[model samples]
Target chain A: GESVGLHLPTLSVQEGDNSIINCAYSNSASDYFIWYKQESGKGPQFIIDIRSNMDKRQGQRVTVLLNKTVKHLSLQIAATQPGDSAVYFCAERFNNAGNMLTFGGGTRLMVKP
Target chain B: GAGVSQSPSNKVTEKGKDVELRCDPISGHTALYWYRQRLGQGLEFLIYFQGNSAPDKSGLPSDRFSAERTGESVSTLTIQRTQQEDSAVYLCASSNRVGGNQPQHFGDGTRLSIL
Candidate 1:
């Protein structure tokens, strides 16, 4: 079965430091990927997205790197803040999957001041 | 420019009762999706509606779960004879169009608790 999964269940980072979260997906056919942040008691907020054609994509303070060869994806947050503490999820969508996103187990990011 | 909206931010009902969760997608969005988030877990895909096409219910857990959409505007997810395991946050999302590359915007979700 095709699945998306995270490399870590929890990642603790120091404030002002950079944080890296990793994900591994089994479906090589997946062409589009997205990273989302979910705060407590809130919905998953879109952070950034990348296409299989692109190896990296950058947002305001976040970046998503895709390694198609290893079926791996990672989200990097610069200057991690307390507000950045939340669960991060990676989702993949294949061209024939009818626009539905397949999400991986989330990685909980904890920022320490 | 309003985002996706879900009603009754929270709902608590007894086991075996039927509950309907509503989703009001963004204006002009042609795609709608429903997902379930268990405590300390990832989001589980439930169902989705794209334009007038038949909805994709493959993600529905069981026959007890069903969803309806009136055109592309509003969608309702109904769970009959809800069980304790059905407790979770039901999230709604919508995108401008139907395609793998289009990013979907989400709502806060309706927390359903089956007591």
Candidate 2:
């Protein structure tokens, strides 16, 4: 019944522009969240992750923001590049689930040159 | 260091045939996982193995699907009497430890086609 979902199915962005992907999760017991990038014919690659206690975390040119009050999560990528084009997914881990991750329907990120 | 490795990058078989998928986790990683991804969909958790603990198989879709892990080494997933709905990409991942905070590294999945 509880699930993670994305607001958009596809996002088109210019090479030099920033991109943002949004996710909404219904489970309030989830404590950990992760973002992954899946390219064609490849497995989902780890991007960044954030814990429920923290609101934001930053990586190389990428940031993950979490809002527990709204049960929302977002991934921000700066200076989108061709390599950044992929299907992005947000996953949540419940405290009692023992490392099991609940994944959201992916958002296809298309970076236009 | 090598990342997670899976065998038979692609597999095609007729309905009613059984299939076995293999996964080799990163050396020294203690936790392993299996997931399924249908066309244009996010991954669905299948099973998990951590150390000597009994595997968590709650995500398995049915009794026809099963998996086994040897200690902390390679793991195998078996599907018996496969059906068309079983067609999907089987993904494997491993993490350094058992905590939820640990990041799981994944390998290119095996694409299974049931005809």
Candidate 3:
């Protein structure tokens, strides 16, 4: 089994404030990374992604940053809202042979109003 | 455009029973994958299908677990002799291709409980 754990650190932000969730991956061969959001009773939904060739990618209200040097990935959400409350996951894909994604432990974001 | 869909949203069976979870990937998706997530845990890759190559069953917990995908469409994950530890949300995802920047689209997942 592949094990990719999170940083075990969470960020709590007030409503309307920006939030940043971080992740650490172990495999340096990982060539692709993605951010997913999972709400209660649902599977993970794609939020944004970054290829190993690039460092940053942004969406409507979300952004993903990858630092290859440190094998670190981060997701930033602007003006975080209650709807943003959920667990965030960062997955890494190493090599293209199988191209399977190994996911991180996940971070629970709490947006307090 | 329809997203990936899964079947039977929920299932409950006694220990030692067998259960099958299904996934219908988005049309035109050539790659499908199966994963499991225990309560409060992250996703665990189970298998991968690219066009027709051998399915990657490396992450499958044991021989009791197997999956099959017909053509480039629906996929089924079977768990035999279910145990209490088998209770979890079985997730399915599909991608446009095997490599590059394509994101894997996921279904809501099938929640399975072994009583």
Can you give the DockQ of every candidate in the order shown?
A: 0.46, 0.46, 0.49
Q: What is the DockQ of candidate 1?
A: 0.46
In Å, residue B11's CA in model 2 sits off its true spot by 0.2
lDDT of 2 by residue, A1-113 (tens): 11112343899999999999999987999999999998888888999999999999999999999999999999999999999998899999988777888899899998999
Best-first order by TM-score: 2, 1, 3
Candidate with the greatest DockQ versus the true structure: 3
Docking class of 3: medium
Q: How far is candidate 3 from the true structure (C-alpha RMSD, Å)?
A: 3.5
What tens digits encode model 1's per-residue C-alpha lDDT throughout B1-115? 9999998799999999999999999999999999998777788999999999988999999999999999989999999999999998899999988874889899999999999
- Quote the positional error of residue A29 for candidate 1 in Å: 0.3
lDDT of 2 at B111: 91
Model 1 clashing-pair count: 0
Work out how many backbone clashes candidate 2 has: 0
User: Which is the better candidate, 2 or 3, if ranked by lDDT?
Assistant: 2
| Candidate that beats the other on DockQ, 2 or 3, i.e. the better one | 3
Residue range B15-106, candidate 3, lDDT tens digits: 99999999999999999999998876788899989898888888999999999999998999999999999988889999998877788999
Please tell me the TM-score of chain B in candidate 2 relative to the true structure's chain B: 0.98
lDDT tens string, model 2, B1-115?
A: 8999999899999999999999999999999999998887888999999999999999999999999999999999999999999998999999988875987889999999999
For every candidate, C-alpha RMSD to the true structure in Å: 4.0, 3.9, 3.5
